[model samples]
Each structure stands twice: as C-alpha cells, then as structure tokens.
Target: MSDIQSYKQTPKYETFSYLPEMNADQVRRQIAYCIAQGWNPAVEHSEKENAFGHYWYMWKLPLFGEQSVDAVLAEIEACHREYPNQMVRFVAYDNYAQSQGMAFVVYRGR
Candidate 1:
C-alpha cells in the first residue's frame, strides 16, 4: 500500500503521525545497510486504523541475530503476508547495545 497521505484522516486520534521515512525503492537497500552494520531486524504491527489508537500496539518478538540477509528478507516477507491489513514495521536492533537502530514502516503489501 502507498503511504498514508494523511495520518489523522486515515486512522488514529493523534493529531499527527509521521510520514514514511523510506520509500518503496529504498527498502531493500536500507535493510541491507542495517544488516551490514550488524543490526538485527524484527517486525511489529498495530491493528488499529489510526495505528496509534490505544497506543501503538507492537509485537514482542525475538531479535534476528547474525541472520543472513535472505533470512531477514524472508521474515519481512512473512510479516507482510501475515499482517496484510494492519500497520507493520521492520526495526533493526543493535544487540551489542540492546537498543533500536532504525525502523521502516512497511509499504509493501505484496
């Protein structure tokens, strides 16, 4: 799906929701960049229409440590398939420091 043109108009009670940081074409490269930097990728989703409704619901998932890019790609693909209607995200974690590096709100519904 394309980015939400307007967040408040699209879903939630929030007055504003940030725009997507990564466009479609940039996804793979950005994921690869995060992996190259040794960050682990994980997925999460919010079921509400205004995703922030009831507070940005998220999945409690394990980190993908030292996983191959293919594995990460496969997991991301799975996330898209699993949560086709909800808002999903791909977040990279720096396990060494145990903190988030970066994240991309998924745009590909395929």
Candidate 2:
C-alpha cells in the first residue's frame, strides 16, 4: 500500500497550478489573453502561509476597459517589488459575467 502519511504535496492555486512556474514571457502571454478577451486585470498578493485563504490584498483597482498588456504587466511588477516576501497573483475579472474569470500565481515567495 502507498504511504499517504509520508507523502507531502505542495499547495496548488488557480490556473497553471499543475504546470511549472511560469516565466515573465509566459505571464505576459496570459495577460495578453485576458486583455484580448476584454476582461479586466487585477493584481493581488498574500503571505505564503495565507495563500489559501479566502481573501488577499488587492494591489490596486482592477484595470477597466481596453487596458494595455504592458500596463497590466507593470502593475504586477510593482506588486511583486512591494511584496517581495509574499505570493503575487494575477487575475481577470469578467465584467459581463460580473465575476472573476481566471487567476494564477505570478510569483511565489519563500
């Protein structure tokens, strides 16, 4: 039988959770996708231990209509710089659906 008790698994967040950590280029691609879909992008961060919690600190207001990919990337970079010790996440808010459309960790902090 497998020793379930001895096996330790890392926590997985939203999109790309099963894949390797995404690079800046990959992140940019995701942001571009969000913008292409006409969804708003938002930045958020949380302490590593609290990453699974229901709430995280929003980096700023969500970027409304027709945001540039570079602008979204800049906000992500700023949040990472300010919260180097915390986990940073990028998300897309769907205005039509009036809810979060997608989310994934952009940076992981130890």
Candidate 3:
C-alpha cells in the first residue's frame, strides 16, 4: 500500500483577477500559446455577471526546480507581445525560507 501521509506534494502556481472583457476564445488562445511555450496549465476558473457584463478567467501553471524570475517574466512579456489584445501581469511569491524557490502568478486582462 502507498503511504499517503509520507507523500508531500508541492503547491501549484496560481493567478487570479477580474477580467470582464475577455472572451472564452481569447483566453483559450492565450493559454494555448503559453502551453506551446512549455508552460503547463494547472487550472482555470471563471464567472459571468449581468451587472458587470464581463467574464473572468484564472489560470495556474506548474513550476519545476529553481527558475529565473527574469526568464519567466521575459516569457510572459513575449506572450503579451504575441497577443497584443491580452494584458498580462506576473507576481512572484517568496518561499517560507526566503532563500529561494519563488512562485509566479500570471494575470491576463482584456
């Protein structure tokens, strides 16, 4: 039997925001581009409202060993350039030790 308690899984990368103008096709295309660039999509969530009349899409990606923030940022920037209609933002989380292993959060706005 597998020891569930002995398995320690790392947290997945995540990004969130309220993007009302982004349509399903646009979001999916951007995600596809990111995946083509070697980024794996972990999860996505969205909601629609008559009041705001906008749709939101949250996405997550998996991170491997140590990665350079600049490299990640550059990749995101390239994505933005490739898709001018999409507004993308990135944030890095500091690990508990604050020594290394930072996390990245990417937000794509319409």
Candidate 4:
C-alpha cells in the first residue's frame, strides 16, 4: 500500500457545519475573505447529495513555530464574525494524529 494508505487509519481531519444552501458566489466570497486575513487555503472540494448531501468549503492555516491552538481558534472566530452568515469550526488534533490544523469554515447549501 502507498504511504498515504498506510496512514489511512490516522484521524487527520475534523468537520464543521454550515448552511447547506449557500451558492457558489457566497462560497467564493467567504474563501476570499479568509485569504485576506492571512490564512492559507489548502483544499477545496464539492459534494453532491450522494456524497455529503451538501456543498462545503475547507481551509487550512499554518501554525508558525510554537503558535498556540487558542490563537488559531481566535483567528477563525474572527473570520466567522466578519461573515455573519457563515459558520466556522476550528479543531486542533494531537501531533500523533496530525500537526496543528483547522477546518476553518464550511458553507453548506440550503
């Protein structure tokens, strides 16, 4: 198996929930807003009814040298405040599972 497959058992992600009816325009705007705040956009994927049954967006922010989880969560909270309609969730996993990472915001379609 591939290295990634070998690590498949590892729990490397966390999820956040958002309105499931957001349109593409709104999703794009939210992503742009997050980027403006200095957070890096790592992955973007779409899901159909057969998949997640809704559409969503996921982002990642780098935790530079010794940054605390609370600090990162605060940044994510700030983004949510900036976008009232958007819901953001931040999760920090143990190093054994994954390094410092976040789910950021997930815009679900209504």
The model with the greatest TM-score is 2
Which has the higher lDDT value, candidate number 3 or candidate number 4?
4
Q: lDDT rank, highest first?
A: 2, 1, 4, 3
Superposed Cα deviation of residue 83, candidate 3 (Å): 1.0
The TM-score values for the models, in the order shown, are 0.63, 0.88, 0.29, 0.31
Give the whole-model CA lDDT for all candidates, comma-separated.
0.64, 0.85, 0.37, 0.40
Candidate 1 structure lDDT: 0.64
**Residue by residue across 1-110, what tens digits does model 2's lDDT show?**
33222213667776686676778888888888989899999999999999988899999888888469888888989999998999999989998999888899988886
Backbone clashes per model, in order? 2, 0, 0, 7
**Which parts of model 2 are misplaced by more than 4 Å?**
1-8
TM-score of 4: 0.31
Q: Per-residue lDDT of 2-81 in model 1, one digit per residue for the tens? A: 76565566433322235445565577787788889889777776664555444544455645564576666666667667
Candidate 4: where is the Cα deviation over 4 Å? 1-60, 64-70, 99-110
User: Which ten-residue region of model 1 has the weakest summed lDDT?
Assistant: 10-19
Q: For residues 1-110, what per-residue lDDT tens digits would candidate 4 score against the true structure? A: 13232224532223323223335455455545544444443433233232233444443444433234344445554555554454444433334445434443343222
Using lDDT, give the best candidate's number. 2
